[model samples]
Target: MQRSVEGQPGSPVNYSCTHSKLNLLLNVNIYSSASPHISLLNLSKNREFRVFFFSVSKVTSSNNRHRPGRYSFLIQFYAVTTASSPMSASKCTRLSGALVKQLLDSVDSILFDCDGVIWRGDQAIPGAPQVINLLKEKGKKVFFVTNNSTKSRKMYADKMTTLGFDVKEDEVFGTAYCCAVYLKTVCKLEGKVYLIGSDAMRQELEAVEIQQTGVGPDHICGKQIDWANVPLDPEVKAVVVGFDEHFSYMKMNRAMQYLSQRDCLFVGTNRDTRLPLEGGKAVPGTGCLLRAIETAAQREAQTVGKPNHFMFDCVASQFGVKADRCLMVGDRLDTDILLGSNCGLKTLLTLTGVSTVADAEAHQKSGCAERQGMVPDYYVESIADLIPALQG
Candidate 1:
């Protein structure tokens, strides 16, 4: 079961903190264990996959047996983290102006994630553009790394410019472009690809001159069972999945058929399960489509986006930026925060997007490595809050 807590508009939230401090509404799912081993999961809006186990029987709770309000299991959240992590599992540091200045001095490159961090939907977050521009003025290298695969680099750059940021196409690093690069450099595919994605994905792949099919709508057949009769393309050696509004059973079946050959490679732009929409509404993301295809093919796809390490590689490898000297600022914890932790980069979470401080508090208690990865080294109320520090 899950419940939501609504807090302040732009304040750090903790799971156990007073409700007044939490402005943004967050959905949190608490797990209860029945077995000897307590299995805790971070069931949040991001669908983070941090799981851990500890002995529930050994827990010293006053109430031992299961009851209506009296719980039988002793619950403790175990988070995922490495021994070398300098971050404290007890708390997420609130960045003071002095700390922010120190962080700026230490990092040479700063990477920003779009959507929640810079802006929510079409409206740009106030002061975001100024902070980004200020970083550039200070001789700091800035880049935009996004898990959103629906748009190409040019499209992202255009959107950023429209939002009043000084952005260029070369500085935009989105999953769609990274997937194309992965296919060309890592996969080294010369044959055709069976693509299940948007036109932007097609644009990126086409820019790299990678041949593909299955871009538009899949026509529904008169016969429900058309798999045996449908012809297969032997040249389709790779099956790439991204955000595709036209994804259907036919597309999934065709992708599976090609993937069933064993030689065909399976790839995905990212693993984000849901896209956070306006008015608290959310639609299925590329992960859903990829899962459908994977279910049909009975094979796991190699994801090229956030928390996968490949996304950061796109920037680090191309720009020669040192991970240790870089800072990653974003809104989402599961993707942005985890990506920063995965790449050994300092992470700052802005609550302008999906995750709130309460989410970090929950993970801190868990001690789960995966959940710990989602916990940022520091957090700010919003990206706009950085403006004052930048001025200093």
Candidate 2:
């Protein structure tokens, strides 16, 4: 008698064995977040049952979107992927079997989501590197699109290389770099920026020779009255928001004060609400920081991230690719899938990230155009599942 638990790496599932260990066999497979089913195949004589796990984390608030580093990813999954789920025969086709060839033949280029589709946090998803490389070898143009503003294009390329993915700096299109490009070309602002983001964003902007202030910590000096008297950069003509580790009341106040001027432009990297991290934990994303400034300034920011068509334009215009000829692959329904739909590209949803099959099902049946953007054209249990198809 033996027992076994099988799951993908970074997949967390809790199992308890109460029965006597008389060589009982238990197999547990923690699949990507996209999978909505949990199959427990019992070879033992008397114990064969499937247990449903659906206890994932919750956002602290819809408006704030901040976790204060207090939420754990250990929250049970929102839904267990099942046969009727979005990617599972009910809503879309699985990119497997004969469909694999069909999928690959349909698109000349592919856009990928960074966090859940290819890698979770600093760790790489299984078989993701091989698939990306194989796609390129087969004449597919590949690009990395992420809403995360914490890292620059060079940094993102470095991380991909560190994790064994064959990627180049230009192939990576992050919101930080896009925001800088938009400011330089579209907005054509020549003055300085009062930034409420990390040095990474600052670097991206500075690379294009955009000057920035309020990047690092601005210590709270004296009292509340002192904040009112804090020196301001009169040259600042724009306010950009991204992931700011040093986001403080002082910084927020500074940004708000700058935006108080009618000529100041408000911008953000992306409005992604939650950032998925290691250990089943998550933190407030740039959206939260951006929203905070928006609330204070009472002005809507111009976001250059996903679902906005700007990120796609960055790749399409530069690489001479067409939206109809491209495929966007990602884990999140709202950002990745919606971005694909918004840009007129095919969308593929992988379960290894923040969204779930149930989420997609709701959108499919919602009868709302907004909700419908989330429905993926295809889905696979994991990006790894595509390896065999690419090989064939």
TM-score of each: 0.77, 0.76
What would the per-residue lDDT of candidate 1 be over residues 75-159, giving only the tens digit for each residue? 3433343343333233379876777787788799999998988988899998899999999999899999988888999999998
Candidate 2: tens digits of C-alpha lDDT, residues 36-140: 122222211111221222233232321211211122223232212222222223345667887777777878999998988899877899899999999999999
lDDT of model 1 at position 374: 81
Best by TM-score: 1
Name the weakest run of 10 consecutive residues (lDDT summed) in model 1: 22-31
lDDT agreement with native, every candidate? 0.73, 0.72
The local distance difference test score of model 2 is 0.72
User: For residue 35, what is the lDDT in candidate 2?
Assistant: 24
- For model 1, the stretches where C-alpha displacement exceeds 4 angstroms are 1-91, 222-225
